[model samples]
Target: MFADRAHAAPARQDPSLGSTDDPERGDVPGWVLITLMTAGLVVLIWALAGPALTNLFEQAIARVSGL
Candidate 1:
């Protein structure tokens, strides 16, 4: 009875679940955008903090040399 019912049901193909011909074509631009944004953020942070870091390093050197 189970085998008869299984054979009577038709196979359905879902259009939304179909495979794409160019899967990797969309990813390259997104990765490039992410990399550029990350680099820009790093440059901005370094630009903002560079002066204070330099002063701190100079102060540490002065204290160490005096000892």
Candidate 2:
């Protein structure tokens, strides 16, 4: 009795589909923002650790030179 109702319905068009007009497609903006944020984080880390790194290098140099 269920054999007559087993036919598939026609495919419907989607209204929310994206257009293909833009040349710079994909996640370019997201990648650029991520790179900028990573660079900012690196700069911040260097700023916070610069003095300690300098001190450590100075101590290493002094120890090596026997001064």
Clash tally, candidates in order: 0, 0
Q: What tens-digit string does per-residue lDDT give for candidate 2 at 14-61?
A: 657755555666787899999999999999999999999999999999
Per TM-score, the best of the predicted structures is 2
Q: List the residue pairs that clash in candidate 2.
A: none
Please give each candidate's TM-score. 0.57, 0.60
Candidate 2 Cα outliers beyond 4 Å, as residue runs: 1-26
Question: Least accurate stretch of 10 residues (summed lDDT) in model 2?
Answer: 13-22
Tens-place lDDT per residue, model 1, 9-60, is 6766676776445575467788999999999999999999999999999999
The residue pairs in collision within model 1 are none
